[model samples]
Target: MKPAPFLLTALFSAAVSAAPATHMDTKAATEAVSVYYRNPNPDRALKIMQTIIADPLWKKDSARHNLSVWAAQILRQHPQATDKWCRAMKQYPAVTQDETAYFFFLANTSESRKCLRNLNISNHSKTYIAQNTPPDISSLSNISPADLDALWTTFYATGNPKAVEKVLDRVLDYAKAQKAQEKSNHKNIDMTGVAAAWSARSNIMQNQDIRKIFDTYLNRLNATDKALLQKILVQE
Candidate 1:
């Protein structure tokens, strides 16, 4: 006997709902998991993720992808949970390229880097690393202004200085272009953001002398701006 049209529609909806909710791609899932990490209810998010990982009917590839990404994020927030998820990913070879890269970033182990370097990443995954990894400013040149803004917001929220510095340099370059385009007085330009960015940069710099870099940038501003920076530096 044929199924009713309404029953078929309901079945399709159920199937889609039961499927894992990932972003556009595996990399997008990485980003989403990062956002979830910063949320106040991280424990709740963890429980939900654990349920997803344990779902027997879930595709092995999708589970591996989700668990690997979630594992790296969990390591950053809760280090103890790392081993179980990492082991699961290793046991299941279906983990995606982005997940492997994330593992390297979180694991910070030689073995993890070796694994990342050997993974067969697609051009898209390479682009993701170029865009997201810290200490790489060149990638910012290829991104759009809106995306750069979003990147700035995320970096600021995460307080991940390495990632912040990469985008901060790009923001400075973008600010320069904005200045030229608007023909605004240098003093009139909103250097509040500039100060915040520089302060964040200073906080992240491990080298004591690198504070000079922020100082040099601060010197270009007016006395009030200099004072504001001084306040930030003092607080730090």
Candidate 2:
């Protein structure tokens, strides 16, 4: 007869645990977490996550980097996990400095900043966070070149495509505004080509959906902007 469901789960866990930390596949672990970490209670999910992270395998740089990136993604999804996540991240301060720095740069709210501040990160990360938290994009209508520039900085720092999307939205809006006015002038932002140019710099644009966002708005830009974008894309 087949073993019970609990017995199967125990056996699987044991199989994974029996592998040496260095031999464990980081991608496999991350994929498993994404698939199975769906507990409704954030605390319970955090507990399960903590169990995995506690493995000696995470002492390696590659594993720790994956863990930190996963931590940032989870925090973005579930801000309620803040206190627990910070406490957990504390256990690997030496390796988390870059992760925490990127997290602080992308943090958009006071509460998010506070949670990042609570982490026991290194002085280098602390200084970078204090100097580089992005300004709030409170009003897209009044968005400035500085705002788009900051988002690009975050994109390069974290390789998150959503940042490029934000720039694309702003450029599209500005293009539409100019088309309505029959004039291509704006606040000297030169943003018409930014989304296409910067997005091309990263391999992440391989996502057809992201590339589609640029194409969807291409017809909306004025002739001048279109020519500039085409030139930039070719040059980039």
Best by the TM-score measure: 2
lDDT of 2 by residue, 1-236 (tens): 00111111222244466676674553345335433323334565456455555565444444443334344444555676676656665676555434544443454445567766666666776676667644443333454444444444333234455665666665545544544555545444445334434544332243444466466555777787775554444344
TM-score of each: 0.33, 0.43
Candidate 1 structure quality by residue, lDDT tens digits, 1-236: 00111111122234445546642233333334434524624344445444444444233443343343334434445545444444444543443434445544544444444555566555666676656643232244454433333343334234344444444454455455544557555545444444434434544353333344455656776776555545544453
Number of backbone-clashing residue pairs for each candidate, in the order shown: 0, 0
Candidate 1 vs. true structure, TM-score: 0.33
Tell me the spans in candidate 2 whose CA falls farther than 4 Å from its real position.
Answer: 1-77, 93-118, 121-133, 137-162, 165-198, 201-205, 234-236
The 0-to-1 C-alpha lDDT of every candidate, in the order given, reads 0.43, 0.48
Candidate 1: misplaced stretches above 4 Å? Answer: 1-81, 91-102, 105-107, 110-158, 161-169, 181-236
* Candidate 2, residue 76: how far the Cα is off, in Å: 4.9
TM-score of 2: 0.43
